[model samples]
Target: MRRAPTQKRSRDRVENILKAACELISASGSDTMKMGELAEKAGVSIGSLYQYFPDKASIIHALAERYNEESQHCLDEALADVTTQSGLIAAFDQLIDTYYDLFLAEPVICDIWTGTQADKTLRDMELEVSRANAQSLVRTILRLRDNDGDGATFAARCLLIMYTGEATMRLAISVPASEGREIISSYKRMMGRELSEMLQV
Candidate 1:
């Protein structure tokens, strides 16, 4: 027997608080995320905020988790069409395009991730998530190599650093979107040649 269609899970009040906190943080930054303001915006009591997260740091960490999970989902979907180097290149390009699109699509959210201030916990969480993403992209690149051996691991590590560095550079500077696309293309071309050599293709 088929079950009736179920509605999506309604977000809890704590979730609403976290969402409000992130929006406020992105707009004005971590310094502006006052608990009082957050509680007011989330339509919850200060005690309720504490019930979910003892401090702002905990709230930011939860936001980071949500961001990374969403990004991972997009990347996984982008790579699904990959099957060869050319296909991989196309997939990588799509992945990058999707990433930048996401960033521009919501500058506020990107600011939350990219902002630098009294956010030691959020910064650490961001680095940890980014490292995992770099490693995953690298592993996929190595698998698509025309020639490979045990050395693929080293090559994967190198690709991870290069690709991640490129992405970081793009984020750091305020280049026009078109120029940014050119930069990414150049980086990809260079990395492709370099990877081809490393794999001795």
Candidate 2:
């Protein structure tokens, strides 16, 4: 945002603007959404919209950040109960399935993720989210058994797992429903096998 919305009303207005942007993006995508269109949809003046978001990219950034935070919450929740090998596998599958559902529920997020490809800040933010998730995975593994002798290697594998999950989820969203389910099932089985192995010394 160009300026933070500090007051209650200001904050609400910004949220309304972002909500409007999300609707517009979901309908036609970010490439075609205009500021005037968003301002009208948000029931705010173009000037007010600009006050919070300097441009369309800023609005997408805000949306992406919001979605990323929500995803982190999902990751935290899904991994919270991970203990034994079966529990960890279940948690991992649950995390992937939950995010897959979230993406299907919120179509705008797919556009926001695609938008991240061209923007460095958004890309960096995405990497941070992955790293944080990997840390959670690493913590779970530490309580289990030594998958790799070094923490760094274990964390690196966790990061790769996160990246693979992310890719599969995105791909799953783009394919037909049946194909998507199969993709998710296959990935879950693979990850489950890997995670189950990690639990053993």
Quick one: best TM-score, which candidate? Answer: 2
**Backbone clashes under 3 angstroms, per model:** 0, 0
Local error of candidate 2 at residue 176 (angstroms):
1.4
Q: Per-residue CA lDDT of candidate 1, range 77-139, in tens?
A: 766667666766666666666666666666555656555334777656656666666556556
Candidate 2 regions with alpha-carbon error over 4 angstroms: 146-149
lDDT of each: 0.63, 0.84
Q: Per-residue lDDT of 88-129 in model 2, one digit per residue for the tens?
A: 888788778878887888879888775666899987888888
* TM-score on alpha carbons, each prediction: 0.73, 0.92
